[model samples]
Target: MTDLLLNHRVEGSASAPPLLLGPSLGTSYALWDAVAPELSIGHRVVRWDLPGHGGSAADLIGPGASVGDLAGLVLRLADSLGVARFAYAGVSLGGAVGLHLAVHHPDRVASLAVICSSAHFNGAKPWQERAALVRAEGLAGLAEGANSRWFTAGFTVQRLVQDHREADPEAYAACCDALAAFDLRDRLTEISAPTLLIAGREDPATPPVHLREIADAVPGAALLELPGASHLAPVQCPEAVLTALRTHFDGAAPRGMEVRREVLGDTHVDRAQARQTPFTARFQDFISRYAWGEIWTDPTLSRRERSMITLTALVAHGHYDELAMHVRAARRNGLTPEEIGAVLLQTAVYCGVPAANSAFATAQRVLAEEED
Candidate 1:
């Protein structure tokens, strides 16, 4: 776990459900001021600075660090706050963190809302170049473009631009590195939270299509596209964003078992439960809570995509026994013989021919028996 202690401020009544607000890469928790006061009326709103930004330390966001690493920092921060589960709203990189928590730490999220963000943030060149420029010339160089991209004239304010200008360059650059390597396209189905996606139609950085891609992927996710709004929709149109959030949180609570079945199938889950014993109870409970309830339940990646990755991994590691079981589960999860073979064939190149050959033989036998 990262020892990053984030600077945070809490608002509203403590008795209310916790609403954790995270800011964009170059901004601090102040990014949410437009909506926080209104949101605090019904919830305990907690806003925190990004690592290396504001009062947070820089050492925690090390080079080549994955999104999960930064996400762990949020979990630790929540732990310190004694918040077991909370609703989340984030912008840009902050939204990415919300996505991470939904996937890796599902039980910790009550509901999620991401604005001007995508599962896979492409265009590594620009992000990398931005980081390089900041390192070379500092925040002043990026300020003008950042201001224009982040907000439209409707709500554009100098203070927000200053937030970008005054951001710690090293920390901002580190966040840029994380964004460059971020790709969760295949894992989108793994998010189990009841989700809401907001997009700015005029935003050049992450357009409505990005929001559409995620909206179409995550099951039952709601989407709102703000006209004339740019990358920072929350800043550009806080009233709309806040309205959607209140409706989403109040509408429905996502069920874990239903999402688990959607991803893993009912028969397979029942069988696994039947095999559980007192000695293995804790293990079963843990995976059920975290893996199935939290991770697999996410609507980010479909069951078929997940099965392919799982089958390939099992074959690569020579976990044939589990592989065989997964083969059956894979079939239930909609993997055809041809698809399974393709995954194995692809695995062969990196894992070795003998492994693929063995996997093929077993997979063929399973398919043939099922057909018979």
Candidate 2:
């Protein structure tokens, strides 16, 4: 049993793939309670209270504390729990942490799901002013402002009053500092994991436009906009969020190699396992399910056809890490150099010549290595 420190909770099947949950600033793991039951049906959900919030140590604070710090903590937590690789889902501050993890430590993340967060929280003057005010007077000074931006009118008057009334003042203030400093706009393209971006249609804080920006920035990211919700969409509209998550993970097939072996035959599964190191092991389940199960099993397309489609999609979207993995999978699925060239040529017509050109270069590298 891993010692419960820093206000984190572990629940669901031990054998299942792990899901690291990052809560919004000023909120506890309780923020995820409404949705955890739904997610736990297929995942071993691990929820963390960001430092200075909820059950975590209050000592964790200041400019030293960052989104990268949070990502590192989650990676450490997963390691403690024997989870080499896992899916990540985060809300607001948590979402920023997920983005950082995907960009800086791609091997540790299998997939990323971000809710109601933006690459940059606010522009220079406004955010700095808010941070200064929070630091001076604490969260109460920011409460009215936060509430108005975070919830709908009815939700603000009713739901938020109950929730916000209990938040610790110091913790909330520290979170304001964290948000003020958070910025990842220029680095969004560096992330390699398959990503899901969910946003509230009515969320004044992060809005649908922010989600669209993230979708456009991150390669191979899918976006979902929820109706009649606010920044706290995980609580206000848990069903919609859960349903979309279930559908996405189900469609992606992010299962373990052992599970894949049971379903996909010994030879294919064994070859994949042989390639795994400690770092790559973290991504095996994602590769098995998404690469093998979901994409590979679609009867609508042959294996060769699916390989062609996947390679083209990864390349066109600029998901270079995934593109490399699929290029290898393409060969395993029996795609010859000629067939791979044909797919790249076809992609040039639909996905701009430059994108196809870049993909061709990547494909050539993979093919040469395989030949060697």
lDDT scores in order: 0.81, 0.76
lDDT of 2 by residue, 62-169 (tens): 443566766767777788889898898899889988898898889988898999999988764665676566567666645556566777776644334434445655
Error of 2 at 127 (Å): 3.4
Candidate with the greatest TM-score versus the true structure: 1
TM-score of 2: 0.64
* lDDT tens readout by residue for model 1, 109-163: 9899989999878757878887888888998878877766787654566777787
User: Which candidate number has the best lDDT?
Assistant: 1
For model 1, state the Cα shift of residue 101 in Å: 1.1
| Stretch of 10 with least lDDT, candidate 1 | 250-259
Q: For model 2, how big is the CA root-mean-square deviation?
A: 16.5
Candidate 2 local lDDT, residue 277: 42
